[model samples]
Target: MKKLIGIDLGGTTIKFAILTENGEVQQKWSIETDISNNGRNIVPNIIESIKYHLEIYGLSREDIIGIGMGSPGSVDLENGTVIGAYNLNWESLQPVKEQIENGTGIPFFIDNDANVASLGEQWIGAGKGSNNVVFVTLGTGVGGGIIAEGKLVHGVGAAGEIGHINVDPNGYTCTCGNIGCLETVASATGIVRLARDMSEQYAGESKLKYLIDDGQQVTAKIVMDQAKENDPLAIKVLDKFNFYLGLACGNIANVLHPETIVLGGGVSAAGQILINGVDHYFQKYTFPQIRNSTKIKFAELGNDAGIIGAASLVKRQS
Candidate 1:
């Protein structure tokens, strides 16, 4: 039974897992991301941790057939260099493949974190058994991954940017300098921004206003909770979010015609309300036949998706 190692590198934390060839997680752990010295310590720390865990489990690098890493930026799969990871503060491209492979004496592969997670879900979660799936993760910012015709769509290795799609011409400017991208209206930050703005416009009292009055940062969870209870202002904000998200999904359906659109990330914590709302608009905006055929659902793999997806990279190569 050959085993593999999976790594998910994020801005704050780096998660790792040991898994069987069939995608079962045998063991998993995480470590804080050390971005000091312009993130010089990040990769080294990961390498050390992997060594420590291997010793604890009484296994050697030779026991692992390969390693798959998911990082948060543009990566060149062929060369294993991260072009840029904004949140990780990688100022320039790093020879990530050389460093990791030299340290572990194992074959390694890499991909964008979002795309890795999408592959994870398709392998063992909501999109299981579906060769074509589009995964959208609605976190602080939106991230997307698309699988078309049983292949991960990598247009110059930077495709599947669903969030940056220009959904509104006059909407708020995104971090990417795009105005009114789907991310601006469908992400957790976007949800809070919409709720805060709407609360100010309305004269009546609202739960979100209480959070504002108390000096607490407004959160998407707060808005979703209030919306579930029928708060007029919160519902309005959610409607705006759902409209844009659904519109995005509809656009994806029209273009890729994927079998499933799996939603994940923090804002997706809203669960049924979030999916139901998005589904309504997705149905309205997608082509009539596509609208009915495409299944919209929640991601089943949550945090584990990263590791599962990373391991799939090795499986894919095999």
Candidate 2:
């Protein structure tokens, strides 16, 4: 059986996996991403990690067909250059593909993590059999991917940046140097920020208050838990947050008209609260004719989506 290697590089963790040609994960491992020194050192660490995996499997370099990676910044996929990864402290990187290939003697490919994640879902997860789908990941920050006509859209490395779209002109500022980006009000951080602001306004008689007496450090999870317990304040926060999220989804649906919209990332663990809320507001905001056709669902692959999706890149090329 042919094997391929997939690496999902994040600011804090490196998730690597070896998989069969058919997308079955044979082995998986991870290591901390040490970015304190500089991002240039990550290449050596990744090579060493791959070497360890190869040694453990008793497999030679020739045993692997191809390698794929997902990075968290603007990537020139055709040239394998990472333009700017603020979180990784990489201003601009070149020859990342060359370094991996030279060290492992295998062909490699790389793309934006969110794009690869969308591919993963389409290939084996919630988006299976869907020709057009939009994927939104609601983590510390929001990230998105667009698949149209069974192809990943890459427009000068800027496509699928749904998170940066201006949702509210008067809303909070985003880390991307934009005001009122969807991520600022719909992401995990956004949820926490909303919780904090709401806690302050409500003052007493809020479960969120009980969780944090001073409301100095309420988290998204706390908010979700409170909502689950029927806390009025928490419910209100989610209602507002999900309304924005659904509005965003409705806009995408109107434009892309995708058959399905897949939601992923940590915040999705809120389950029905998120799905039902988004669905409700999406119906309210979406075009009347398109509302019934666009389906909303949760990503099934979860954390494994990146690795599996990375492996699917090889399949796609084949």
Q: Which one wins on lDDT?
A: 1
C-alpha lDDT values of all predictions: 0.90, 0.87
In candidate 2, what are the lDDT values of residues 66-145, reduced to their tens digit? Answer: 88888887787777778678888887665688888888888888988999999889888899999898999998889889
Structure candidate 1, residue pairs in collision: none
Each candidate: RMSD: 1.6, 2.0
Count of clashes in candidate 2: 0
User: TM-score for model 1?
Assistant: 0.95
Candidate 1: deviation at residue 217, Å?
A: 2.9
Model 1 misplaced regions, further than 4 Å: 203-205, 209-216
Location of the lowest summed lDDT over 10 successive residues in candidate 2: 209-218
lDDT digits (tens) for residues 263-303 of candidate 1: 99998989898899999999999998999899999999999
Judge candidate 1 at residue 193 and give its lDDT: 84
Cα lDDT for residue 198, candidate 1? 80
